[model samples]
Target: MGKNRDGGGKDDEIIRASDDLLTSLSKDPSIMQSIYALLPNQEKLQGARDRHRSLFHQVVDGAHDKEAELEAARNDLIAQMSLVNGMANLTGKHDPTIPQKLGLVHQTAGKRPSAAGLSVPENFRMAYDGRSIIVRGSAVKGARSYEIWVCESDPLTEASWRHHATSGKINRIEITGLTPGRLYYFRIRAVGASDTGPWSNFISMMAI
Candidate 1:
């Protein structure tokens, strides 16, 4: 398992807020370059203002320990550096992608996730919305990911089920592409590294 500095699968509201912020930060070209600059794996680029590794570590550690304060500081620094360019950070109490991006993990990408520790998803429901139906699910313990399978007809046979969507760490997903007011059957499963757990008890809903 990789050191999930991005908070692993823990779902804290504040952590999610921080993650959303960091994901936004990663988009700015200058800010992204700053991250790449400090990445241990990256070769120093010409003309890049390479920050001191000690200072970088300090910032990273501060993110984990002082997230609330870090949020304010991160915002202020971004505003201050609006013109200077190449300012970036991946520190946070919640940002899970940081460890992977910063070369801090040995995570194996594309490996099947395991579902041994999780039970079937619970509280599965469908939300009515104009022209779409949202599939909501509750997280299962010991699972890091989820797969939502949906069928337009009764799922009495394998051929009726279709893979719909997958989520990373979260339990809820929004689904579209169905005829409005059609009866749809849905089920979900916990995904593991090498196998998938049993499907949740199927639920049927009329799409709005």
Candidate 2:
């Protein structure tokens, strides 16, 4: 009798361990659904399915928002790069001598006209010899040629406008047959194939 009772207790222990293992495995959907008739009600299973679906939607929406932010940042960077390139195209290479070359050089007091156009530099000067007005100036270093416009008054009216000379170089030019003691205005501009610089400061002189 004692041996039978010990054998029965050992079998009960083995059966309990096997039942625990099977119960753990039944948490998986494929295994649990195959044994659904022996498991809990439909409402509890549906609740678990709805929880997983909600979690999936949350992850997808979060990923979509992140992508949108990344796209916006990418577009902003592209626009900034384009703006930098445009400014670089406008500025060209850095040439330290360009500013000095473009600027006007001052004239000595005796050589400068007292009552003529104020702020006209000595390098861009017009003087009156007894026969004609002599206009003189230097061209920008890369300039191919220059154009000179000699007028009687300011550029506000067309009646006073006339092209005095167009020259490949900056040299002394004599304008003859002008009325003595008459005020005249002149403008000089430098040009190249790619660009025309701003007009040199204007100079005025009277034929004495």
Best model number under lDDT: 1
Worst 10 residues of 1 by lDDT: 83-92
Assess every candidate by TM-score: 0.41, 0.36
* lDDT per residue (tens digit) for residues 1-208 in model 1: 3323532333354366567768888776587788565443223321222333333466687645555555554444333332121111123114645434533333222222344555656665555433355666666666667888887542545686899888875444777677763556677777766667667655556554
lDDT of 1: 0.53
Q: What do the candidate models score in CA lDDT, each in turn?
A: 0.53, 0.51
- 36 in model 1: Cα distance from truth in Å? 64
lDDT tens string, model 2, 1-208?
Answer: 1223322224454467667758888766577667555333446435544554555565567755455545544444433333333223223235423323433212222222222222222366565333356667754655677778766543334465687777777667666766774555567766666655555544555554
lDDT of 2 at 135: 67
* lDDT for position 98 in model 2: 32
Clashing pairs in model 2, backbone N/Cα/C closer than 3 A: none
lDDT of 1 at 167: 82
